[model samples]
Target: MDVQLRQLRAFVAVVDEGTFTDAAILLGVSQAAVSRSVAALETTLGTRLLDRSNQRVTLTGAGGRIVTRARRVLDEVDRLERIAQEARPELRVGYAYAALGKHTRHLMKAWAVAHPAVPLMFVQSNTPTAGLSEGIADIAVIRRTLADERFDMASVGCEARYAAVDTEHPLARRRSVRLEQLTRYTVAIDKRSGTTTPELWPATMRPQTRTVDGVDEWLTVIAGGQAIGVTAEATANQNPRPGVAYRLVTDAPRIDVRLAWWRDDPPPCLDTLLAMIRELYSAAPPGLPRQRVPMVVPPRARGRH
Candidate 1:
């Protein structure tokens, strides 16, 4: 009954940043404010939240559950407020090449017909650079990859991986391929620094690695018979060069088209964007995956429970 937005905000900050001091810095508030907010939140919920000792803070069992729900609620509230302030305008969405797959044409056509009045702004983004980290997209249809925690994400769908080689290449005849098998060939990937590569590639197949600037450039190398490459079905669809083809890599994670917001509290322009994105992703054909951590196991306990 006495719950407050500040309490929720404070708790989420600590859970994400891992320290009262860090949360306070991010909120531009005193550490005391953070500690007080968390304490008050625990009292209101009738649960002990943190176990702090040894100068290291840890979340209790209940803290994990509470923080998860609090993040969702706070995020929605933020988005709602922004939506209220800004009159509906055309939604702008940012995405890398792989996010908009072969079916993008179909999706756009249907979206236009359904919400023609709402202008749709789509920008093609190449490479996963500071643009996404700095909050450049409302919904970023990125490659089959897990976005960093810094971004609010909604999975579009999985992008199946394909192996592209010259027509006369030995492995071209096979319906599928693996990373281990491609070790001998030259490999190309959109190297996303700071993100986990193993999560993207489940199978252990290492090829001579190379990074390309854009999809077209990547296609050129593939078409020239200079290198073998792995790409999502969407990338293959978007850049259909004559000499290249992609098939199941066996190890590719299901790529997802995610709706992202810089902060949990999104801007109003973001709401329309999110709404439109949600509508699009909801009806998306199978193969896209959203984030689902099986169980958020908190760090080891330190202070009293």
Candidate 2:
């Protein structure tokens, strides 16, 4: 059976308004149009929906059962319309965790100066796509690879990796830490959206991992000293918790920060956004490699030396 959304809307509207005249007024359609819509709906459903008696409209057994479902359907249709409306002018950039970190404000200010009418907003969604796939955002800041062919991605920048350790942890005293040094401790990782993974280290050297769903949980676990966390510099810059010290992961590869959008339906101002990001990254990028402190040997190795 062909079920039209308008027909469902008309049916629900009639039920809500008590009279066909009121329903027509609410829908901004003529009473005749409202009557015809309701008639067509009943005809399509192959059942009498309403009892029109004494200029009053009341529900039949079938109508009573169907009215609730029709309201639900109309509600869903309204939601779908809202979703379509969201794709208009404003740009919503979603991120699974900490957005551009220290650069977030800079980018916002730059975008505002460039495109004052179209607002640039950041939304946090702890999903792999950030929120692109879920329709919660028009663009996404994805740290890891999003293998979906449905979306196109641009490599905007890269962030250095940082080790999150409790202040009391011995490694926290160091200016920087290495992957090998962290191997002895359990690492907290958000497998879905986090940039770090066990694969960063060789199979033999990989640390025991504790899985977390989001950044808050990861930080809590690290602050509690249950596990150490290795994350993008963005996390360190934005999320500094008490008792949690962030140290640069000197030898680990940097996390590639990328912007992703639907391949078929990229957002407006995308080029401007990309250009601003490139300029920001190019102007004041991550620290130079030469600045990295040499890895300090652990106490065990230092004792032998």
Candidate 3:
């Protein structure tokens, strides 16, 4: 009932070293202490573990069986400790959809060079906060503003909105389409994780909507010509489907790409990541306009309506 790790270690040490004195020296403890620890272990198990009647210390039959299992337990405990110590070094960034779009690879390469000691990992989770709320990620790249009070986020960049339509659809022939034109089709949206919502349209002009769980489903539905999808321009660049065509939504507001983390105890590299991303967006090529929105928002005012 009351077993301790030290007791197990002491028993195994005495068995391997062939004597209590040698085991005590290996453990940096007194011989009497090692003897007491082994005795306590045997008492707890209600069995005699060591045959002290012999000149050379030997194990009882029960002790031999238990020792093998005890050694395995000790080894697992050591492994767990090592994992816990190494766990904090890696940074995991979660995303619901296109993670920073075309900038993802460039940002990863830059971080590798800038912080070689700390590794970067990307996780995809189709929840609204990516994996932040689920505790699977230290930071998340989300398309919309997160209104949760527990998180702090920054607008790292913005991208033009685009409509995804079937390749054979009439609108696919046009170079771009306005928000009003999209209202004519049934729009597919991922209500849980998607940035596009019915609220984006005026009350009376709102398009009929269909719900999909993730990006792939949305693309599939759009490709089937039963619905159309409105998403960040990055989605077009990141996920190009053969049956789907992406067209610019010239009248819709640009989608904001945000980086978010828990506010109370943010990762140590948060500020560095923010700066690196800000620089990446600022250095975008001539044609792409870089819009720098102020990063911080008041805690209580954070979630999507």
Candidate 4:
């Protein structure tokens, strides 16, 4: 009944990476350490979690049933640790790629003027929840809608899509590019936190893909001229890398920016924070300049599409 967090992490990593060697590499540990941790986890749970017969590792029925619960436990532990490490009272806003794009600093200054007592801070986490679920941030700025009912969300604004290309690439010379136009090239994507996916294109027109883990890697691949990337406009504003250029994706749909927090345990000054965000968004509707954001609209009331 005694289980360690490291054991759970090792089991989860192996399940995620499909090989012990890869899991070790991810965790910055040796392969023997990963194997020992998994073994210890299985012993503690009194269940065989993995099938290691083939070149790739797979989950047993028990593992399939337990992985989700394990993830929840880890997330809760992480949240607890974050709460314990707090140095002061401040609003921690999380984002995966770009935090509010060009609106980030304006929002911070506005919050400072309104809530002078509590500082507003932005943190980056390359996860789907942008560090919200991981307990790294008090709230999250997410491009994609959260389906989890435990959290409540409101749309703050929408941003146009852009194509990231190498400076030497032909697409870099164009003012804008169409979705179909990039189909002939390989697309670099972050499946975990990135908004763009192969699903965005028609099945027949979908381009070859190279998977990257984060914004830095995505930019590197694109800068190498081996691949291109599609992302929200905020990336262009916040992450202008050398040898990489961003052009508008004229045919792509705009990405909605939303603020999400725990529904049952809303943060302090929640209403004030939400109002400030909406005010900012309304003032500038993506392409406009210095427009106030609108009133709060709940996630349930709006469809992602």
Cα shift from native, residue 25, model 3 (Å): 13
Backbone-clash count (model 2): 0
Model 1 reaches what TM-score against the true structure? 0.53
**Model 3 quality (TM-score):** 0.74
For model 2, the superposed segments whose C-alpha errors exceed 4 Å read 1-88, 287-305
Give per-residue CA lDDT, model 3, range 1-305, as digits (tens).
89899999999999999999999999999999999999999999999999999767999999999999999999999999999997768899999888877778998999999999888888999998999999988999988768899998888877888888887787877778898998989999899889899999999899999999999999999989889999987787778877888888888997778888999979768889988887877787412222122334558879956
- Rank order (by TM-score, best first): 3, 2, 4, 1
lDDT of each residue in 41-70, candidate 4, tens digit only: 999999999999999999999999989999
TM-score of each: 0.53, 0.68, 0.74, 0.65
How would you encode candidate 2's per-residue C-alpha lDDT over 27-141 as one tens digit per residue?
9999898888889998999999999885778999999999988888878878998999875568999998888888899999988898898999999999999999999999999
For lDDT, candidate 3 versus 4, the one ahead is 4
Model 1's C-alpha root-mean-square deviation from the true structure amounts to 22.7
**What clash pairs does model 4 have?**
278-293, 279-293, 281-293, 282-292, 282-293, 283-291, 283-292, 283-293, 284-291
**Residues 132-210, model 1: lDDT tens digits:** 5545544555544454676666554454666767655667666677767877777766665212233344355544567
Ten residues in sequence with the least summed lDDT for candidate 2: 287-296
Error of 1 at 230 (Å): 1.1
lDDT of each: 0.66, 0.88, 0.87, 0.88
Comparing 1 with 4 on lDDT, the higher-scoring candidate is 4
Provide C-alpha RMSD values for all models, in order. 22.7, 8.2, 12.0, 20.8
